[model samples]
Target: MSEIRKIIEDLRKNKAGMRGILAIIIIFAYGILGSYFIMGLNINNSIYYTVITVATVGYGDIIPVTPLQKLFSTSLALTGLGLLAYIFTIIINSFEENLHDIRSGRHMEKRLAEMENHYILCGFGRVGTAVYEELMKRNQKVIIIEKNDEKLEDIEEDDNVIALHANATEDKTLKKLNIDKSLGVIVTTGSDVDNLFIVLTTRELYEDAWIISRASKKESIKRLKNAGANKVISPEVSGGNDIYFAAVQPNLVHITQNHGIDFLEREFEILKKHNCHLENIEYHFPGIRTPVTRTIGVLDEEEKDHFIDMVKNNPEVKESLDVMYNSVNGVHSHWISGPDKTHVDMAIEELKKEGNLLGINLDFKEINEFTKQFKE
Candidate 1:
């Protein structure tokens, strides 16, 4: 029973490819051999007759004359008809299954395309699954790209979570997933080689995307990092460290288990605060061409010169404190403080009056609201 179940499962996953091959072989062998011996016909004539007979397209040009020949013809007709029925059943089932897969794949593709500022997880193993769970717990949108379809079969269905059965190393797959628009990618396949390939491919597709890769071997860590992975982790190393910590520092392990699990959750709040600061500025100053304003990090070099200078000189304008600069692409984005919204506004207005030197544009988050709007 177990063996039968295993075979059925394999067939279900493989789309009857092996069964189709075996059927073709049986049909050709039986057709040629049966017709040649029973009809006493030449190879070419026997094959032609077999084709017509099996397809139920019998032409009157070939007819069985002897008793034995007629008996064989009747037997062959029964066998052919039975085979045809079986073939039709398989074909129809295959057609329906293919149609289902087409629809499912298209839905996955559309979901992946619609994802923006999301993370692409390129594996479904233990480490990858852990990361996925943590991200989901934080309400982060995640699209999983795993080559193994069986691994994806039981995934929990959610709008923010999608599983794509595709090779991450393929450029077409990454492009179809809109890797360039993603915030980052995580490669956690068990193989260091596969992770390295995925990192390289993802980096090629999206230079700005943050990529984290898993390395199995100690020596492969540097290689993975050099291959464009922003962070490279060896599961073996982490696992060993975890075991050591659990043995020697049980209290620390408990603290980590209790607290570190929610680290990503806190990141969600931090991201929300940052976005609220930017949106507050945009909302308050509508006539300032708010769409043409940009945000920069507090630690940016440009901020040290322009933003810091203005914020330092004018203590009255303290509502917004982020600098607005135009990038080569005519758009730039950064973070600001909520209290400094007015300062940034006045600075932008002053710059505009001085003659539009910075050709900028607009940009603009919640927890449940944030997840619904931004998550995947």
Candidate 2:
């Protein structure tokens, strides 16, 4: 019963097109009935007289004097004339609406079909915008599904993106965008619950697509991950990490900032050469002499600079750096080096002063400790 009601509602929504089709049918019927009545009456006038009489534009040239003719004329005038008016009106409105829908539908279908390996971003808020900018910088293809009209208006002018102003959790909308063919999906809406819903919907619809979601609360992280989000991030958690790193590892932060050796930049270079992690064996440091564990995070400025320089000078090194940078997460350990120890240290101190780390740090000792712990 509910399904029947839904079908009825859908039909109502497309009533305009149906009305147009009905109008055409009625017009044809009137023409056929008029032709038959004229032939039966044995009218001597031209076919123009038949058309005029049936159309209610009687010129008095062909009069229906016989009772049968009068009766038929009266019936046709009442029924056919009324139907003609109603059909004309309905058809005009219907065609206009149908034309609009058809054009828009075809355009959407064509665009979706042409898309391949694109990123399906499930919001247009601040975080979503940042993600889009980053993806655009890398020349990645992206499609945005945002419910907010104002937010969508902001991105409509961008040629690189295909924006769908609709609910992200709707299977219809996601399917229209060809989510199954997408490389990944990012849910960065303001609501953690909304993000989770989007993640769940995408996972269910396209089980192989990678999903990254944003969560507001700590508890939502596990749920989002379980819902098939490859990664779940909390803005609050990131902010807290930055604060803690500034307070605890001010020196390291300063070094990283001064040398301009950041994670994103390093990762970008590494992926250019080597596409995967398993292919690389050795990672060179800037000024450090000792060999570092694979799982250890590097905190010193000089060491980070050294690593950056090595990757910059060699193509293979750059490729490796890119791969590692792309793969590393908040949970993994990695090395960071700039040019000189003093410069690195100074930069780290500056970052600490500026509160960039969000209270997170990877000191030499901490790196060693984490590496040992993970190894064991």
What lDDT is obtained when candidate 2 is compared to the true structure? 0.57
lDDT of 1 by residue, 9-42 (tens): 5455665546655765787677778778878889
Q: Enumerate clash totals for all models, in the order shown.
A: 13, 37
Relative to the unseen true structure, what is the C-alpha lDDT of residue 181 in candidate 1, on a scale of 0 to 100? Answer: 67
In model 2, the runs with Cα more than 4 Å from the true position are: 1-90, 156-159, 239-376
Query: 1-376, model 2: which lDDT tens digit per residue?
Result: 6644543454467665466457646654654555466435333343455466557897876666777777766775666577667656655665566678789989877887788766777887877776776555434567888899788876643445788878987778878777776666778888987888888888888877767787778899999989988777777766322321221221122111112224534443432322111111222233333433354232234654576677668788777656653332212322232222344444434445543332234454543443344334
Local distance difference test, each candidate: 0.58, 0.57
TM-score of 1: 0.54
